[model samples]
Target: MKRVYLLVITLFLLSLNMSAQKVYSVEYANQANVKVFVVDYENQADLKVFKVKYQNQAVKNEGRWFFTDYANQADKKIFFVKYANQADLKIYFVKYANQAGWINQSKLHLMY
Candidate 1:
């Protein structure tokens, strides 16, 4: 009985640590100018605005902050993959511009 209890505890601890592992690391943390709007793409894709955040303790001089349109809202994705993989900003912007028609026409492309 004691062995089974210990096994359960050990397994729980292992799962906890494993789940805490970080996802793909980013090299240029703030270099990417693309504003990751915190909106639920599943329900709506409204661009969220945000203000820049700064902490004197971290940046003694200055810092950048941003406000999202969907501030304090749900996360879009853990990390951007397809959006980042697109050719370049030009292509991405063009695609974004065209998506409005689909949305307006009530033809959202769901990958299901």
Candidate 2:
């Protein structure tokens, strides 16, 4: 019984964490939960975002972003900036999609 309880609790936490992983890019900044910029260099990014091919492949707020084909399917919607200076959040793409994560957690709230 105790083990079962622990498992349920663990799953709950995992779901919450996973919920933060899915992201959708909105067409306009007004529709986005956050405004993002893709930095030319990794060092200039606030978060290292991994673009997952599938939504199930996305992980928690660690920067795993799953771009939904439709905007309504996304957890947190975001808009990309043309320039780093115009962005509220700056991100860099990693080679492996799962390798995504936030270098700076300070701006995390903007997503939620």
- Per lDDT, the best of the predicted structures is 2
Q: Per-residue lDDT for 1-112 in model 1, tens only?
A: 9999999999998754431111122234343323232333423432211122322121111111222233232111123334433312111111222232122222111110
Worst 10 residues of 2 by lDDT: 15-24
lDDT of 2 by residue, 26-91 (tens): 778898888889888888888997777777877556777778878778888888889877889999
Residue 39 alpha-carbon offset, candidate 2, angstroms: 0.3
RMSD of 2: 4.0
Superposed Cα deviation of residue 45, candidate 1 (Å) = 23
In candidate 2, stretches whose alpha carbon ends up further than 4 angstroms from where it belongs are 1-18
Query: Which run of 10 residues does model 1 get worst, by summed lDDT?
Result: 56-65
Model 1, residue 35: what's the lDDT? Answer: 24
- lDDT against the true structure, per candidate, is 0.27, 0.79
